[model samples]
Each structure stands twice: as structure tokens, then as C-alpha cells.
Target: MRQPGGDEDGTEPGDGEPGSRLAALGGLHLEEAPPDGGVPATGRSPRTARNRTLIVSALLAATLIACLGTAVHLFLRINEPSSAERPPPPPPPRPGASMSGPAGGGPRPVAQPVRTENDLDMVCADRFYPSAPRFRGSAPHPVMISEGEETGADFRSTRTLNRAAFAGSATQRRTWAPDPERAQIVACLDLTGPGRKIRDCRAGDGTLPLVEGRYRLAVYEVATRRRILQKDLTGTDRACPFVIRTGAGDTLHSAVKDQQLYDLLHQRVEG
Candidate 1:
């Protein structure tokens, strides 16, 4: 089955091509060149090419991300205000604002309260029973309750220096004004009217009377003339009004209650 001008494998020899002649002579096999204008062989493995492609793609992605971040940062900086907003300054104070106080911020003098026509000022000084009354055996200490005070003077619910009240029948146990010869303590509560007063009438002395009442509860020792205690009494309506409300007096007395003067003379017998 051999053709007349062909080899055993039916191949042509010396067909006017160098590759064909070399094949006809046998043994030498030359590699064919790739097609014209094709890519040249670099002899690199597929793994190497794949790795290079991955590196290039990563570089491109990084560059894109960096550019996007830069663009966002610039946009934020451009849209912001130049500086932060601030509050307006306060207005200046008016003239003579500090004239009520002392100059150069010294201690400001407290202004005394002005006495109005109807104002009742019955404030009195404070003193306490620092020492208990001493007793000799058991003779009742005689005390004189204040009487014939100024018309408008009275005692009410205790205030300021007051610690008790002098209610009506609940407190009037004994005589109002006892004789000074029989009494050992004179609970004298004198008064001076807010209105104008004249001199002494019985003897006709020309000296002016007091303006305001000295609202006090002064307990005096009869023979010794030593002051036991003097407390400021609370007044009613105007200063030191005798009658206001009815009860067991306004407050509790430290030493005596009920008939405060009588209770003081009778109960406070411990020395």
C-alpha cells in the first residue's frame, strides 16, 4: 500500500521547505515559530504569570482606595465653617449701681428699719435664769406682777426673747399687783406708748415720758435688789398687747408655766 513518491508514513520529502527537507532526512525535529505578530514566548510558568497578575491587581486596588479616601477628606474639610461660633459679650452695668454700699467694697452699712405709724416695735434684750433662786427653809418667794402699764401694752404668743405666753383666766391665779413690802420678786413689765406722752401728773414733773415700751419680763429680788432674770416678752396687736388668744400661753417656759409668776415663786424653790 506504499505510494510511489512517499515514505512509509505517507509523508512528503524535500517539498522545497527547510523543515520538510530536515524531516525527510529524519532524526532532526525543529520547533515551528508562532504566528506572525503573536506574543513571544517568555518561558515563564502559569503559576508565575498568575502571581504577577494578582500583584498588579492589588496595586491598582490600593491606588484606587487611596484616591477615594483623599477625595472624601478634602470634601469634608471644604464644607466646614472657618471658625467656631462664639457668644456675644454682656452689656455694661448702670451708673451708681454700687453707691448703696461703702466705697471700694468695704463692709456695707446695714440700714436701720424705719418706724411707720402703725408699726409695733417691742423688741427687748435677752437674759436667762443662769442661777437658780436659793431657798431658806420653805418661805414662799413673794413676787409682784406688773400692773398699770400703758393702755396699749399687752402679752401674747412669745416671740424673739419670749419663751412663754400670759393667757387670761388660765394664768391669773393670784393678785395682779401685790404690795412691794410683802413680795420677794417684782415681775415688772413696763411699757412706753408709740404715740407722744406728757410728764408726771401726780407730782407735776415736766420731763417727757418714753416713746416706745421697754418690753421686758424683769424678775427682781425684793430685799437684795438683785435681778434674777429679764426676758423679752412677746406682744400682741401692737407692741406688748395684754390679751390676744386664749390657751395655755403661747410657748413653754423654761422655769415656770401656767401662772408663770406664781409658779416661779412656789415651784422654783430648789437652790
Candidate 2:
């Protein structure tokens, strides 16, 4: 059992002992010496600690710089508008030519009697009652009606009183003259119906003669001849044609140039 040399703890040392012998062979004293080329057993090497501290300090500096920049930007934004403030704009101008009366040297003009053509134009549309009798003229048969679309922009219905003429019961083709020229005789409408809305007229001239009498004319549709929308040419003519937009209660008075379309409307009304 006991062969070679007895070890320190009463066990034989093998050809290669585990710890102290190996250290000694490699030039290290177990209790005192360090391995070959190894650092001393003091604290830590100055260079390693310095490098780690430098890296941590660099990261911390970067974080502090980013925070400071963000704070500065927020502060500038908050102060810029208040420091460079601009005043509110002035109120808009008043509408009419003169705020005072024409006599006060504001907008001077002599008052004159309204002429015949002016009176005739005045007969076109009356704003007070949009679908009432707007034109009160010397014409024999006065026709009033309302027609036009109901706003927005879809297929909607419109209505108008084209013309109304009283020609003494005799059926005859008549020649009517408007201010500009001799326009063809279109359909005449009779506003004998229960409901009638008269609108204002936009007449350029206040002194135009409209023949005073009942008339018979043909109402022709410029668009389609479908019986459902065809007009009759045997009624009174408004001083002008008025267009009504659906939904919105706004009314539009047509110009004399638009009488042809009015003629069509007259047919629709009467028919």
C-alpha cells in the first residue's frame, strides 16, 4: 500500500501533483509568486480602470448633451411666437357708395321721376312676396308663377309662368316687340291657377311698352317634347322670367335675353 514517498497529507504524490507542484514547475510560488507574465495581485491596472471610466463618462456626457439640446429647442419654440407677435388685421370696408345721404356731398345725385320703361321693369319681380305679383303694369293680362330647381345639383323640378295674353277670344298669331327687337311669338300662359308667386324683374330700362292684352301663343320646349313637361302658350307673361333654386329659398330673375327660355317655361306652365 505505502509505495514511493508519503505525501504531506499522508497520500503519495503522483507523477504530477494537482496545485503547488504545477505552479512551482511553471515558475510560480503558490503562496507568494504570480504566474509568468501575469499582473500583480494589488488592486487593478490603472489603464483598464481608466479605459472603463472613460467609456462610461463618454456615454453619460452624450446623454446629458442630448437632454440639454432637447430642452433648449423646447424653450426657443415656446418664446419665439410671444416675442415676435403681430397685430390683428383691420375690419373690412362698408358696402354702399356713401354712408351719408346723397345731399350731404357724400354721393350727390338729383332725384328724377321714374320713367315708363323703369316702371315696366319694376313690374317684373317683387321681392316682398317672391311668388306674388311683382310686376304691376299696364298690360291687360298679368300672369305670375314660380319655377326653378331646388338647389344642390341633382335632377330636380323647376317651374315658371312663360306668358299670358288676352287677344279678345279670337285665335290669331300676334307680333310682339320687346325692347331690343322683334322676337318670335312663343306660347302664352294664363296664371288663373290657385297658387302664384311673383318675383322681381331685372329690367335695364324702366321705360319699355308691353302690349296690354290677352294673347295666344305656342309653348315650345327647347329641351324635350315629353308630354309630362310640355308647356301651354296661353297665359300671362311675367315682366321677366324668374328661376327658383330648390331647397334654398333664393330666386333669380332672368335678363331679357333669356326670354326664349321663358317662352318655353310659359308653355310648361299653361300646358
Candidate 3:
């Protein structure tokens, strides 16, 4: 089997075959066989992959635990009541008792009386007319006639006076009179028939006289009514001058002669 220029042992020239010579020149060596299922084709060990998986799983478990703890904390915070959501405290008990009732057993504190302007007006009205029966003598003193021209004999002769006299009921005359505390008397007169006699009654007697023609006196309160003096002479001559005492021990005199009262009444009635 020896070819031409070949050795007798089937060996090529130059110490080995051409492939072996190339292998030796390239420094190649025989590789050992790998054990079954020991290492993958990717050259990574099975134990290394398992370790990486374990580390990833441990990290995921830690993240899940942290998220669960945060959710629980948030749930508790949302469910708990804040200070602003809490109920208010109860009010303190009254001094007299723990519960309201009759005196001593569970006494209720007495409420103090409150006086209003309406109450004061009511009181002033009541002072002029009382609930109890009063005789003509016991009633408010009549206006006195000191100095005035006595023209007519009786006040009923005047058409105006006659109409006013019969206008009210007997019951109203008994209990009703102008409130003198707050009202101001604008005019006082003693009249006779067709002849009109105007007199300055302020200098005269305190009592307003009702005699002769139409005896009419205007009494008014500017605060309650817009005009103090009536627009027409339609009422009886029963108004008189009165004195009111103030809390400061001063006496306030209200009469027809007051310049302020005369001006205000004249402005309203005349204008």
C-alpha cells in the first residue's frame, strides 16, 4: 500500500499527516467529554441558574411584603377618625340643677325680665288708662281755663265737636284717653258759636276747657305718627298740659306753647 515517496508504515513525510501538522501548528488539543446534563450549550452551570432564580424570587417576595405592609398602613389610616371628625363635647350644666324641673329637686334658673321699647310704650299707654274702674273725678284732671275768651256756651254747638263727641262708644270713653307721657298738646281753646276765639291757652289754667263752639285740641307724637298736629280739627277738647319726671329728677313740661312743638305741628298741618 505504500505510494511513491511514502514511508513503508503508511506515514507521510515531515513527521505527520498534513492535518496533524496544521493542528500542531495551530496549538489545538483534544477536549474532554462533558457529563450528561451537567452544563448547557450556552456554557452556564445548572447550579448558577438556580441561584439566580432564587435571588430573583427572594427580591420579588421582599417587594410584595413591602407593598402589602404599605397597603395595610394606608387602610388603617383611612379608616381611623381624625380630630376634626370627632364629636363635640357637651355643654356645661346650669348652676341650679343637673336637670331642669321645679325648684330645689331640680331647680331651673329664673330668667330675668327684659324691657323693650314696645313694653315702655305699653306702660305709657296704660298710665293714661287703667284696667280698674275709675270715676270721672278719679280720671285724668281736666284742662283748666285760666284766661280765654268765652264765646259759646257749650262745645256741642260746633259741628266738628258734635261729630267727635258722638263718634266713640261709652266703653271707649271710659278706658281710652291720649297717652300724655309721649304726646304733646299742640293747641287749647274755649270756643263759642260762629265767632272764632283763638287764645294762647299755655299761659292759662293747666286744664283744657271744653265749652262753647268747637273745642278741639291737637295732641300728637311725631315719632309714631308722621304729623304731630292733626290735619283737621276732628277731636274733642279734652287734651291738657302734663308734667313728666325723668330718671335724672328733671321735670319735662309739654304744652301747646313750646315753640318747637308749635313749629312742627304748624309745618305738618298747615303745609
Candidate 4:
């Protein structure tokens, strides 16, 4: 039999039924609900949402990579040395010393000092004329000779002597002449000897004289009072008769027929 306001199943229309209870519990609606009554749609599809998420993730990854790269660049720049901050290069190695190794290794040969002609000239000028002195009159001092004529040739001879003095064969101390500008009294030959009358000896002022028969030749060191050579020549048997007596009293006679000394004297006389 049918009941009032009940269905055939014997449950009332609005009563707690299985379908209604399920609908209430599940919060589902069979018909479309009002806009303000149910959960609202996000107005975006699932695929669209996923795509937006992937785009954001990609942007974040790129930004992170850029920051890491920038940090690495900064680190490298800070560690690098600038030109001014860098240490200076080492100096060049000295002569005769090996760049590598020590003792027992053969020492490298050292280069000898080289002297030029101009250097020799300057040395001669200094040795010949050291200082200026007042003479009796404007008549250029009798002892002072023209540097251009007298000293030039003598300079050449002195240059030769300098080389000999420094050579390994030299037995005397290596010495050079005084500055010519400081020299007051030039070297002069004392003609009060018998050899001067025999040879008709005539030497330019400030020149070394060439004499014959028992003559003495002496070379006084320029800077000091030391005498290097003092020779006494006697007899006429030798062609260019001359003798060189060292300070040690060792006597060296010139070659019997050698004209080297004569040639040197001729050059001085001509100049």
C-alpha cells in the first residue's frame, strides 16, 4: 500500500535516504548549482595549468644558471693579476757566471774591456794638460804644446802602451795618465847632458827626445811619483839603440836592428 508523501520504496521524499545521504556526504549535485552555491571552477583546463607551471620552472632554471655563471666570472676576475700588481722580471745574468749549476763546471770566459780610439784620445788629453798656469807673458807657455799636433801622435803611442800594460805579458802594474787639463808642467828633456850635443838633439816642447850615446830614458807614472821604467843606453852597436830598465832593476835591451823606437820618434818630431 502507498503512504502519503512516500515513494514506492517506503521512504519519505525528503527523509534520510541512501541516495540523498550519499549526495550530501559526497557533496555532489546531480543538477547544475547556482554560481554562488558550489565550488567555483578555476576557469583553466588541467593541461593549461601544467603548461604554465613548466614555463615558470624553465624561467627559474635559466635565472639560476645565469647567476652561477656571473659568480664564476667574478671569482676568476678577482684572482687574476693586473700588470701593475705583478712582480717584476728578474735581471739579466752577469758575464762569466753560469745561469745554472755551481762549482766544478768550467767557468765561462769573461769578455775583456774594450777601449775605443776616442776613449784613448780623451785619456791622452787628461794626461797631458791637467791644469792651467800663468806664463811670463801671453807668449803661449814654452812648455805647452798644441794638443792637436803634439799630443795626438803621443796619444796613439800611449794607447799602445796601455794595451801592453793590461796584457797578460805585462810585468808592471796597470796604470793610466792624469787628466791633461790638470797637468801644469809638461814633460821636458833636460838637455844638460853630453848626449844632447852629440846627436844635435832638438825636441818639440812636451815631447820625448831621441838622443844617442849614453842616454837615459825614464817613464814616470802619471798619477803617482812612481817610476816604471829607467833605462841607460850606452854604445852605438844597436840600430835603434835604447834600453828599458824596469823598477825591479831588470834591464831589457831593444832588438839590435829594430827601428820601432826610431819610427816613434820620427812621428813625434814630424807632428
Candidate 5:
């Protein structure tokens, strides 16, 4: 072979080029091989591996610490008392128990008794009638009568009398016949003892002599002692009279009727 520079052998300008197949074939070029066996790795090296090992070890230690902390917290919570299951205790009371001071106190004051209507009626009776024997006599004409139930509101004790009984005496004495006027008077004073006193004893007309004093009353009148029977006794003949006796033996009679007796009686009994 001939050389271009007039050398004895044929040789190129790049004689030491690396990875040259021509240089390996000894065609007058020198080539060099790489110092490393192959190409570099795409990722980490041994030092990186050591760093990774320490990083993994640190992460594992952190996980263990976190788990231990969680376990300790759960252990403490399980041992503690639960407010949901327990009930609150009741409050304590004082030693002595009472409404006024403390417990075991004294009694309080009570109210007084009030007077009723019944009490007032009994009082009226006792005040008016104190003597037992003061309402009885003869004509003054006295007729005996018995107690009867006070049915009417006005007149506690009353009965109708025959008008004809006073016909003979009517001409001589100014007398009222058995009418509303006479019945009215009996109604007023009989129960209260006003009817017992007859002052001016004309045959049929008269006034009662009621002195201011306490008197007692008997429930009965005795006409047997008078021996005064109804003579004509016909056509409502004879004196239609009412008689009442006191507890002390005095008797009351009235031929003239008054309304006051009945009114007072009515108020006391039914009302």
C-alpha cells in the first residue's frame, strides 16, 4: 500500500481514535478502550442505597413511636371512669327538719271558731224568755192550746178560729171577726211572748201588756181550770181565741190577730 504523505506504509491522520475497528485491525491506527466496563446506571448507587436504608430505618422507628403513643392513649382512656355510665349523687339534707326553723319544729297557730245561725236563734230565745211560769190566766179570758209545728214561714204556731163564737160579744165589744186582720196580729206576737199579756179585757177587743223582761215559756196551755166551754158552739159560735203559757205559769191569749207574730215566726223557722 502507498502512503499519502510519502511514508513507506499506508497510515491515517487519526491513528489513536477510540472504538475504531480500523485501529483494531492494525491498519496503522491506534484506538483506546473505555476505562469503565459498560454504560453508567440510570438510577441510584451504593451510597444512595446506604442513605435509603437509614431513611427506611428512621420511618419504621417513627411508625413504632406513633403506634406506642396511640396504644398508651387507648390504655389510659379505657382505665378512666365513663361519665355516660355513672349517675350523679343526690344532695345531702339538713339535720333538723321543719317548716318554721329547721326539721322537728313546733306547731303553728290556729283560727278561732265562728258563730253560726243556729247559735243566734238559741241566743234570741234565752234572751227573751228567762222565767218559766209567767204566761197563763183566765179572761182576761184564757184558753189552753197545745204546741203545733210551725209550718208557715211567717207564723210559727197558728190555727184558724171560728168567727161566730164572738158574735154575742161583738155588739157590746168592738171585736174583729176571724179574718185576715186578726190572723195577722196572732202571726206577729205569739211566739215572741207578746200575745200573752191582755191588759183591758173587753169581751173581744184588747191590747197585750208586755213588760220589758226576760220570760221562760212552756210548750203547753191548760184551759181545764177555766171551765168556760163554748155555749152556743154552733155556726162557729163562741170566742175563737189563742192561748199560750209561760214557763212560770202565766198564760197569753189574743182574740185580735196581729201580723208581726207571723212575720217574726216565719223569719225564725223556715228562713
Candidate 6:
């Protein structure tokens, strides 16, 4: 419904307001001229308004993109561990001692005994040679025991090797462990050093330091629990073949070298 007073806002005819009068007469309003009579200053063009909206939208989009990029960079920097965040590398593998696991088992770490001296002075680079005569008859299976309360390695790996060796060998392979009191022969421990830590273990000029333990071991006939033979007994009986030296100050003072002890019995005693 067209109002009689004006187009909509109630402006009458012949009013000085050109805009309202023109709007009442026609839909288009008159453009007001500039002060210098140059181009007219009119209402904002739709195209120019649309261009400004597009530019503002583009700027906001770019800002949003930059913000996202910065956020992603910060996330990576936070998640990625720095040198301080990373754990220290494991200590490098030790040197010298190179023994591996025992036979028939997976890799058994050669557990080093407590920190003893990593080195020893071979006062005499003495080879194993006992001066006693080779006795007749079969050698008994040695029931391995030790000098103190069995703790630490107790030379356990050596014992593991010995047990495994006996289990594998023919000459001294007795399934039953022999009683020291009742058995015909017993290899008893006579002395042991501070493992591989003793400064000088040599008792005499030619005798070996009681390194691991068996260097001073004695073979005794149980009836008379006296020493029938020491490391000095004749015919190639060894003092102790010093075992291996492992990583970082790891060493074996008197680890028996191999299964040669039973092999010696295999060589000597008559049936």
C-alpha cells in the first residue's frame, strides 16, 4: 500500500529534500554533487563493497593459515625429543674379556665377578706341569665345592663348564654326585685368592698364584683325608689355566681353561 504522504517514510511533495522527493517520484534518488562540482558523491557501489569484503576475507584466510602453520611447528618442536630429553647411550662394550655363553644354552652372559683388578702380574709365565708320577686306576668324578659360603659367581660359570664338560665326557661322567666322606677320592679346595684381585698370589718361585681357586686344589683319598696330589703332582697336571678376561676390567683369575682335567684322566689311568 503506497502511503499518500510519501513513498514510505511520509515525506510530502515539493519538499526541498531531493532524495526523498526523487525517491517518492521514482525509485532512483538524485546524486548529490561534490563541493567543487566534480563527480557526484553517491551511495557505495555494490561491486566496491563486494571487493572490500573479498579482500578482508582473504586477509583473514591468510592469517588463519599462518596460525595453523605456527601451531603445527610448535607441536613438532614439543613432541620431538631434544638431546637432553633422550637417554644417554649405553656404555660402550667392555674390552679384554671375550668369553661367551656356555654350550647347549643360548648366549649366557659371562657374568663378571665383583670389581677386582683387571690385570695380574705373571711372576712366572709358568705352564701347567705337575712333577708327580701318573698313578694307576680310574680317576674319580670330582664333586666340585668351594672354600667360603657360595656367593657371587662362586666361579659358577667355571662350574657350569665343568658340570657340562663332565656330562659330555666319558672318563669322569658319574650321574650321581659323590659324597666327600665316603667317596674313594675327593678334589677339595685348599685355597682361593681375592679372585683376580690378588697382587701376588705366588706362594713360591715356581708355584702359581691361587687365582680362580683350583691352583691350590688338592686331590685326597677320603679314607685318609690327606692330600694325595697337589697342583705339583707329576705328569702334566696344571696349576690352573687362567680363564678369560672380559669387558671393562672383567677378568677370571683362575678359571679352568677347558675339559682337559677329565681328558687327562682319560689319558692316564688304567682300567
Please tell me which predicted candidate would have the highest TM-score against the true structure: 6
TM-score of each: 0.24, 0.24, 0.20, 0.21, 0.19, 0.27
In candidate 4, stretches whose alpha carbon ends up further than 4 angstroms from where it belongs are: 1-43, 87-271
Largest lDDT belongs to which candidate?
Answer: 1
How much is the lDDT of residue 142 in candidate 5?
18
- Give each model's whole-structure lDDT: 0.39, 0.33, 0.33, 0.34, 0.30, 0.37
**Better candidate number, 5 or 6, judged by lDDT:** 6
lDDT of 3 by residue, 71-124 (tens): 999999999899899787886753422111113432122232212222212211
The digit string of per-residue lDDT tens for model 6 on 1-271 reads: 5577554655457576776466665523555555785654556666788999999999999999999999999999999999988999997754321211112432222222212111100001111112211233555433322221122222221122355435665544341132222234334332233343333333325333433433443444322233454452111223433332333022224433335344333222212
Q: Please give, for residues 96-185, the per-residue lDDT of candidate 2 as tens digits.
A: 212111223222221332222222222111101122222223332122222212111122121232233233222211212222111111
Q: Candidate 5 lDDT, tens digit per residue, 1-271?
A: 6677543555554454565445455433332333584323443456789999999999999999999999999999999789977687776753221111112332222132212222112211221112211223322221112122221112123232333234346421221222221111111112223322324323235443432222122221111111112111001112323443323223223332323222323232222
> Distance from true position, residue 136, model 4, in Å?
55
Error of 3 at 174 (Å): 74
Query: What are the root-mean-square deviations of the candidates from the true structure over C-alphas?
Result: 24.2, 20.7, 25.0, 22.1, 33.2, 17.2
Instruction: Write one digit per residue (lDDT tens) for candidate 1, span 1-271.
Output: 5678976777656766786787676433333335783433534556789999999999999999999999999999898666565455676854433211124533222233313211111111111121223323453453444432332333312211122223333233222322323344445454422433322222124222223223445555433334576665433322222332233232211122234444443343222
Show where candidate 6 strays beyond 4 Å.
1-48, 75-82, 89-250, 258-271
lDDT of 4 by residue, 42-157 (tens): 34456788999999999999999999999999999999899899999997855422211223542222232213223223322332111233222322211111121121122222
